[model samples]
Target: MKARSKRLMLVGGGVALLVAAVALVLSAFQQNLVFFHTPSEVAEGKAPTGKTFRVGGMVEDGSIKREADGLTVSFVITDTAKVIPVSYRGTLPDLFKEGKGAVVQGKLEADGTFRASEVLAKHDENYMPPEAAHAVEQASKAAATVSQ
Candidate 1:
């Protein structure tokens, strides 16, 4: 083959490989991406099912229940306008408590319960996750609008 043809072939092969690598990286990122949602969004059926995602809100007062096994715990997370039931089977963070802000990473089950794989609590009394705070604010605004 001519030198020119060989050079063009090499360049085209390199470009193809580059494209394939980029595509692979993006695909992996997409698969690992976790989305954030609020209780209201989950109630409205906007959250994805059978996939990992995050839900942030306040743990409702008197909603925490622990099983006899001591490892399994159930709680309700709410944005004041709506609530989602979450079941977790593991040790909880020291900061986790009822009526405090929390973010749970898990999947929505068929029965409308959130099966949590990980739970994160707000680090300080005054600090709340941005997403959780936004969700609470939005929910309160929505409630006020409905009342008016």
Candidate 2:
């Protein structure tokens, strides 16, 4: 083959390889990406079922319950406009409590309960996750609008 033709072929091969690599990276990102949702979103059936994602909201008052085994706990997370029941089978964070902000990573069950694999509580008295805060604010605004 002519040198010029060989060089062009080599360049085309390199571009194809680069395109394939980029496609693979984007596919991985699409599979691994987890989205955050509020309790209202979950309640409205907007959250995906049987997929790992995050749900953030306040731990509803008087909604926590511990099983006799002591390792399983159930609680309700709420955005004041809606609530989702979450079941976790592990130790909870020290900062976790009712009426405080939390983010739970898990999959939604067929029965509408969230099966949590991990739970994260707000770290400080004055700090809430930005997603959780925004969810709460939006819920409050929605409630206000409904009441008027």
Candidate 3:
């Protein structure tokens, strides 16, 4: 009714609308966000089911298997504490090899294998993606704690 009251109401409405817009944007962004999971997390069932995500870790030594077709390859990824099976049906990166770090983007299947759509392997023996490195560090810490 009063001019001052009208001005206050309008400001409050504007602020509320702004807050709502921000919340909506954040929610939409969250839906599209794909998080990187280590083999430990995947083994613990923390990976998203049916939705695409990233899994990064070292390719377990002696775990690489290639189909007769040559294009389909399966390997086990390990973060020391656990291992996740991944299958990719494409030419792997030149750097992809056993005991090397790799990051695969794809969906986790109901049977516990990650169906990779893309694979990025470390170019050097000392190199790893930052997220994969952090995950390995965390896994090592957890393994140490458990052993203690």
Candidate 4:
């Protein structure tokens, strides 16, 4: 082959390998990606089942339950339009409380319960994840629409 042809082949092969490497990295990142969903989304069947994800909302008033195992805690998470029961087997954050915004990372069970592996409460009265804030805004709008 001509020297020019050989150089072109080498350049083309290098570019192809770079592209393949990038694609592989992106695919791996996508596989491990977890998304945030509100209780309303889960109720509407938009949340992923079987795979672990996140759900953020306010803890339902009077829904916190302490299991016999003390470490196991269950509570209902709600975005006003819908609710999902969640169970966690660990300590809750100091800021975690009923009727406050919180985020839980876990998987949704077939029985409609959330099996949380981690629980994160809002840092303060004013701070919440943007997604959680949006969910709360949507919930209030839904409540208003229902009452109207």
Query: Number of the top candidate by lDDT?
Result: 1
**lDDT for each residue of candidate 3 in 33-123, tens digit (9 for 90 to 100):** 9888888888888888999899998899999999999999999888888998899999999999998899999999999989999999998
The global C-alpha lDDT for each of the candidates, from Candidate 1 onward, is 0.98, 0.97, 0.92, 0.93
Clashing pairs in 4: none
The TM-score that candidate 1 achieves is: 0.96
In candidate 3, the residue pairs with backbone N, CA or C atoms under 3 Å apart (3 or more residues apart, or in different chains) clash, namely none
* Candidate 3 segments whose C-alpha is farther than 4 A from its true place: 1-32
Among all windows of 10 consecutive residues in model 3, the one with the lowest summed lDDT is 39-48
Question: If both were scored by lDDT, which would come out higher, candidate 1 or candidate 3?
Answer: 1
Query: Which residues of candidate 1, in runs, are more than 4 Å off?
Result: none
Per-prediction TM-score: 0.96, 0.93, 0.78, 0.88
Task: Locate the minimum summed-lDDT window of 10 residues in model 4.
Answer: 124-133
Clashing pairs in 2: none
lDDT for residue 25 in candidate 2, whole number 0-100? 100
lDDT of 4 by residue, 50-98 (tens): 9989999889999999989889999999988889999999999999999
**Residue by residue across 1-84, what tens digits does model 2's lDDT show?**
999999999999999999999999999999999999999999998999999999999999999999999999999999999999
lDDT of 1 by residue, 3-117 (tens): 9999999999999999999999999999999999999999999999999999999999999999999999999999999999999999999999999999999999999999999
- Number of backbone clashes in candidate 1: 0
